[model samples]
Target chain A: MATAVVARPVSRTQTRSREEEVLVWPDLVFIEFIAAMLFTITLFLLSFLVNAPLLDQANADVTPNPSKAPWYLLNLQELLLHMNAAMAGVIIPTIWLVIMGAFPYFDREQHGQGVWFGTEKAVRLTIVSAVVGFVGTWFLILWDSGKIAFFLHGWFGLSGGDSLRFLENVRSVQTQLPWPEWSRNITYSPVNIVIIGEDFQHLDFPAWLVEQGIPTMAMVGMSAMLIFSLWRVGWVVTRRDALIVLFSAFVAAYGVLTLTGTAFRGQGQELVFPWELKVSEGIPGQE
Target chain B: MTQMQPSAGAAARRIEHARQAEARKLSRRSFLRVSVFAGLTLSVGAMAAGFLGFFNLRKPTGFGGVITVVPARVPKAGEEPSRISEGKFWLSNLAGAQGDVAGVGGTGGILALYWKCPHLGCTVPWNPAFNGAAVNFPGIVGWFRCPCHGSTYSRAGIRVYGPAPRPMDTMAVSVNSDKSLNVNTGVITSGGPDNPLRAKPYSG
Candidate 1:
């Protein structure tokens, strides 16, 4: 016996009608217009309230006590105080930009499109990452600024003559490792090393590495841990979820750094209360 | 039956041969397309370079640009260095004896030094403490001290001590007809064995 197959025609209009979209003219255009107006008003208000600083005519002879970069670049300048200039100014930012560019390629899912914190799990992850970034960056700024370290030292009664001498000795000398000469030599190599002191006379490369690496590792490691934990716990089942956590963390870190640089840094680029800051001088009426 | 089988096998071979020929044609077309794209990219890059040159697009003013430090904010002789923000340098009016000591030649002797420290490029500030009796360089009236590093420079911008490889860099200084100071920051003389005072100082 032979069997015949039957073919039915499908309607093109029905399939075409499934696509739902709002008109760009009124829907998107009106929203854009409102956003532009809001932005302009905010800018006008800011300009009215604050005047641009104009310092005394360019004197080639004296530099201000703590010369700072423009506000937008202050984040990198803040980073410069803690880490190697090359890493702070170039490497880290370049890596972040590359990662941001590659994000779309890594997350190809369309389910989360046009949605803020697309899933419940993504919202939780973002909040956690943001908290981690904020606390981590703040801790680093305080520790590196010597506020916390000196406070702890003084609290522990280590500021006295003998205790201070012991602390100085501990800082000056490198701890001897039981490892072989080759291993020790490899460890001692100045790859991500810096020598900082009154004259950079000390050869404390390991300490410098550890000091600079803490904040960097904390930021990166916390984000990685969040992704890993989310994956293991089945919270982040997709690449988009992982990227959401990472990007949220990055935004938080950027905001924290900018805030710290703008408000916390004072004369000599030292950490100070916002009210105590004396760096902003030469504004028309501020003087 | 054998003849029919032979004909079927020949047809199969013909189909295979045709498929291979088609693949070769497709590959050749793709290669041509790639070469055209590469050529187009190179031409566009060349055009961009030519356009930039034609438009005289140049880098923004930096250390090497000649800048006018106006109003002649010259420090009194034996006074502290005057900070010139536009030029990003310090202009010091050295005493005649100090200018002679540094071999800097001028009737109204002045020296313009880049604010950057030679060791790590940190801004060096003049510390009045170095002139006090308690300091090691008590005889020196004032000295440049690097806050980042303990490098010190004498009144003449010579490296007195510390990790700084050499003395501070000096720029060419000349007085304009209007009595303004014209500093050729572009022509930087490195501090080494070269005489620091060789640049003609601005006299107004």
Candidate 2:
């Protein structure tokens, strides 16, 4: 976790003497009294300036466009866009929680306990992972939304974005798949599977491939890729370093997802600029 | 003589006697602390139970009750779907839908699909015209397309694409002797797996 970088309290207790010892009655109590008075005054002024507004009455019909989860859950909501709802909404979060719970057991090195960063390389790793995680997640979201395709097509007149129609404009716009000819032929060819756009929806194999196979493989593959790259770079030699990278990445991803879900997502959960966001009140004409 | 086991009354009296003996040791501060904690626990426990019972999925009544539709309103196997906004369902027949979608329900029957998108409960509308260019689905004219998460479903309510967990939910439809359907919105079953089960045929 990134520790709050507020002012560190002076460790006067380390060199304590009876001469410096203060009584709890007037000395400590007076300071506390002043603090309490200051807080009370600040709160009074704040409340006077800011008014709490009541929201619209909850309605069952006509879903509010861009219906968002609470801020804490926006990450999961954003994840729900990229893959299967079960994997995105349920299984992934559950698995993540379990792994985090078991993280202490995996990293038993006694050096890091009770400290914000225990290892010598921790500060460097945190910054690197944070940047990589935040940027990588933002990039992936854009790529999935086909904004990258839109840009490539706009800039270079590149014409491979049509291959992304696998989901029929379901989760993304037309993706410019500038992949080689062999991959294209293999991809769009009538497969006995669900991931191949329209032809395979009737079959069971394709459904599993789309809903289960791809998500699981993508998660595993990405993590493996990260670890492998880190190992090769000599950045992650120990399990502790690897875990720190993973944790830092996770935190960074969580933050980026929250930001994306909050700001970047426009109507219909489409990726758009923050200014483009319009809350469709589901009022017939206005919508 | 062996000691006789205490009777219910005797046991209660003995517990009362023990309580009184223990009560003698309780100072006012400890007594107040114990009583306050006990009161808080009781209120919190009652509230938790109240919340569970309040939100429990009982029969969806009022707007979500059984909706009966005459035979004429039910769409043909490949026609435009009839929407019941009040009932939150689309009445469509999937028997003769083009493409591989005809595989559902064999000869097909009248399917009462709950309009709520299985992904996040946005009402899905049926596309009136087939647009081959609008994605990969060959014939999407009579398909249910969700605008919320872009989850599209075949006429049979199977998840064609998007992040929908499964097929759109189906309300139980009972065909009557006169060819009318009594669709119970209260009883909802998942589309189940990738391929949705066939609905009961209204007529040949």
User: Which candidate number would show the highest lDDT if scored against the true structure?
Assistant: 2
C-alpha-based local distance difference test score of model 2: 0.69
lDDT digits (tens) for residues A1-287 of candidate 1: 88887687875754445357556587778899999999999999999999767444454233454566678987887776665456677888998899999988898888868798887687888888788778877876765554554555556644434223222211111122122334323443345444442223333344443334544676578778878987898888778888887887778888988898888875445567899876433322232
lDDT (C-alpha, whole model) for all candidates: 0.63, 0.69
TM-scores for every predicted model = 0.44, 0.54
Q: Candidate 2, which CAPRI tier?
A: incorrect
Q: Per-residue CA lDDT of candidate 2, range A87-167, in tens?
A: 888899999999999988998878767677667677877888888888888877776665665566557866453454443
lDDT of each residue in B1-204, candidate 2, tens digit only:
234455766899999999999888878899899999999999999999998998787675544787778777777666666777667887877654332342433456677788888777787766554242233443355556565665667767776556786678888889888877888988777775323345676663
Per-model DockQ against the true two-chain complex = 0.05, 0.23
Clashes of each: 14, 6
Native-referenced Cα lDDT, model 1:
0.63
Instruction: Mark the 10 consecutive residues where model 2 chain B has the least summed lDDT.
Output: B130-139
User: Against the true structure, whose TM-score is highest?
Assistant: 2
